[model samples]
Target: MNLKSAWSRRSFLSSLGVASGSLLTSATAKAEGMFGKKPKAETKRLVDGNPIVPITSGLGSTGDIYAELGVKPLINIVGTVTVIGGSVMKPEVMELIRRGNEHFVLIDELEVAAGKFIARLCKSPAGYTGLVTGGAAAAMVVGYAAMMTEDLEERIKLCPDVATFPRNEVIIQKAHRYAFDHQIRQTGAKLVEVVTREEMIAAINPKTVAIHFTNIQSDRGQVSGPETVAIAKAHGIYTFNDASADVPPVSRLWEYPAVGFDMVTFSGGKDIQGPQASGILIGKEELIHWALLNMSPQEDRIGRCCKVGKETIFGLLKALEIFVNQDYDETLRMYDARAKLISDAIAKFGVTARPREFNPNALGNVTPRYSWQIDPTKLKITGQDVMQGLADTKPVGIGSFGAGAGGMRGRDPEAEARMKAHPELAQQRRRGNGPGRDPNTFGFAVWQLKDGEDQIIADRLVEIFSAAPKA
Candidate 1:
C-alpha cells in the first residue's frame, strides 16, 4: 500500500486505542500509559538520583521503538560513522541531558558557562575558549564566519555575501581539499588552493583571512600543521583545523589548540559519545565571541539556523568529561576480549579471526579491527557473501561489513567512466586493509558494539557458515 494510506490506517487505529498487530501495539500502549493512573510514590523514586528510569511494570516495557516503526536497528560493526548513528551516549551524559531538560535558561548564558567548562577540561591555551555547535560542519560555518565578520553586527547579518568585507579569502592546500570544504564555502569566502610551501606563502594576500587544515589528511599535503600555523602567524591570519574524527588518543582535544591553530573543531558525536547533533569548537576568545555572535541566540546571522539545544550542550560537556577521564587501556582490553569471543566461536568453521592493532596516533577513528579468513574448501561462500548474510539478519540487521565505500564521495558518473577506462585507477581504489575486498577475507571493528552485541554477531556468523553450501 501507499505511504499516505498506511499512515492514515495507523492513525485511525491509534485513535480507537486498538492494537493493529505489532506495528501499532507499542505506540498505543505508550499513549494509554501517559494518561493512565499514576504510579505509587515509592515506585516513582529516582534511581541513584537519576530522575529517569526504565519502565518495567505494566505493558512490560514499551518494546523496541525501532521494531514498532518497522525500522530494524543494526549491530554497529562500523567504528563510528553518521550513517549508523555514530556512538551511543554514556549513562552520565544521558543523565545530564535529562537534567538539562528540566529547566529553561538563557541560551547565551548557558553557552558561556559550558564554554568555560570545555576550555578547562580540554586544557585550551590561555586566551582560547570553546563553543558548542550543531556539528563539526556547523563549527566550520561559524568559525569561518567569525574570521570574516569579527563581531561586526552589520557583517554578521550580511554574511555569505562578503562583497564589502576587507578579508574574504581562505587558503587551503590542494591535497587537503575534500567534501567538507562546502561548509567553508558557505560563508562566501573564496578558497585559495596552494600546492607547495612557496605557493602558500605567495597566496597570503590582504584578502586572506585564514588557512584551513584537514587534520586527517595532514600527511598528504606539502605543509604540516606546525608549518601552517607558523605561516598563518607570520601573515597575521587565523588558522582553523577540522579534526572531527581524530580523537580517542583523547589528547588531540587540547593538542591541536596547543599546536597554535587559531581554531580547532572535533565531533562531539563520534568517539565522544555525545548528542549526535553536537560539536566542540575550541579557539581564541575573540574568535569564539565572534562565532557566538554569528550563530544562534542571535538572529539575522549566517549561523542562526545552526542552533544547539541546551540538552545537547550539557550532554556534550558530560560526554567530554567521561571521554578524557576514561581508562583507555582498559577499554582496549575490553574490545580485544569481545573480538576473541567472536573469533573463538567461528574458528571451527576454518575461519581464522586474527586481531589487527590500530595506531593510537592515527589521524582517524582509532579502533582495533578483526579479520576473518574464510576457508574456500570448507564453505562455498566468499567473504563478501558472508558480509551480505550478516547484513540480512532479521529483526536487527548487522552492518559495517564492507569497506564503506561510496558514502561521502557519492555516485560520480564521470569519475566512474574514467575509472572504467583506466583499470589501474580501479585497482588503486581497491587497495586497502579493510575487509570485503578479497574473496577469502572480511573484517570490522568491535569498539562501537554495545554490551552483549558481540555474542549476537558471533552466533550470526556461526549460522552463516553452517548454512553455507559445501565447496
Candidate 2:
C-alpha cells in the first residue's frame, strides 16, 4: 500500500486503540536511561563501589527481544563491527525505516530523490551525484561497472561480460589488497597490484579502467592520494575508494571525493548507525548516472542481482543526516566516560585500565579503547584466562580481553606490516622475547555499548576478577 493509505490506517487504529499520548509516554520512558534518574536506597552505591541493584528492575526494553527469543543478550564492549551486528540503530533511523516499509514508490524514483538530497549534503561537485546501495561492497560492484562502460544497451543487457571492453584492469596497491577487493573483481575487472609509487605509475595502461584506493590503507601505501588521483586523471581513468570504516572524523564523508577520487563508498551501518544493509556511493554525476542505469529496479543490468530495499535507502538517508549533525565532541566524551567507569571498577586490583589508542592500522578497529595493563604476578589468572572466563559467561561479554596484539586470537599479517612501519607499537607489542610474545594486556571499547549497559559490563569484569585465585 502507498504511504498515504498506510498513514490513514495508522490514524484509524490510533483512535480505536489506547490514546497516542499514552503510546508516546511509553516510548519516552523506554528511551530514558534507567540510571539517569535519581537513585533510590536499593540502587545507591556505597563507599566500597558495589551496589545492591537488581538487573531486571531498571533495565530498558532491549531485554524484551532476547527474553522472548530465549537468547541471552551479552554486553558488547567491542567497537562497532559486522560480526557483532554493527552499531545499534538510533530510534529515529528505525522509525524512518518502519515508515518507509509502509510506502510504495518506484525504486528508481526514490533513488533519484534520495540521491539529490544526499548529493546536496555531501556538497558534491557539479556533474557529481550520490546514490545508496546494499552496503559498501555492493557500491564497489556498481561503481566499478559505471566507470567501465557508458553503453546503456551493454549495461542494461549483458554487462558483467566485459571481455569485449578494453577497460578490463583495475590498479590497486599491493598493500591495499583487502578482502573487499573481491567486490571490484565481481564486475570482471582484473586487479593489477602495485607496490611503490613507481610501480603504481607503471601498472596503468590502456586496459586500466580505474584505480581503487582504500582509506584505511592510506597510512601503509607509498603512493599519496594526490598522486593516485593525479595519475588516474592524467590517463583519464576513474578512481574508486572503499572508505567503509574511515569515519568519525566525519569530515571524511566528503573529503575523499572532494579531493579527487571519482567515487567513494561508506558503510551505512558501521559508524553511521544506519541500516546494516545500506551504504552510500558519492562521486561524479556522469559516473553515478551510469551507476543508476546499472542499479536495482532496472531489470537488464549486472547490478540487478544486488538489490537495496526501500527501507534501507530511506533509513540510511536519515542516519547520514543524524551522523552529520551529531556533536562529535560530546560523543567522544561519553565514550571516554564509559571507558573510565570500566577502568575504575578494576583499579583496586592493581590492574590499570585507561582510554588509549588500540588499533592504528588498516585492518584494525582504529579507535580509542580501554586498555588494561595487568601485573600477572599479582593475580593467578592470566589475561587469556580472563578472556576465556568472560567468553564462558552466561550472556558472554565480548571485548578485547586476551593476551595478544590488540587482543586478536592469532597473528594478522596486516597488523604485523603496520607494526613494522611503526617501531614503537612493535616494541609495545613485544612483552619479552619477540614480537609474537604474549603481552599482559586486555582492552575494551565503549563506542558500541548502549546507555545503562556500561555498569553491567563493569560488574561482570569485577565478578570475574573477584573469583580469580590470588597469586
Q: Provide the global lDDT of candidate 1 against the true structure.
A: 0.86
RMSD after CA superposition, every candidate? 10.1, 13.5
39 Cα displacement, candidate 2 (Å)? 59
lDDT of 1 by residue, 1-471 (tens): 111112355345543443234335555566666989443222222222323334554432554556546676788887678877888898789878987886778999999999999999999999999999999999999999999999788899899999899999999999999989999999999999999999999999999999999999998999999999999999999999999999988989998999999999999999899998999999999999999999997999999999999999999999999999999999989989998999999999999975576888888888778888898988898777787788899878888434344365556769878987987767645543333357788888888888899999999999999999988
Per-model TM-score, in order, reads: 0.83, 0.77
Candidate 2 has a TM-score of 0.77
Model 2 per-residue lDDT at 284: 85
lDDT of 2 by residue, 133-212 (tens): 98888898888988786746764466678887878899999888898998888888899999898898888888889888
Model 2 weakest 10-residue run by lDDT:
44-53
Clashing pairs in 2: 127-285, 128-285, 156-300
Residue 422 error for model 2, in Å?
Answer: 25
Q: After superposition, how far is residue 281 of candidate 1 from its true place, in Å?
A: 0.5
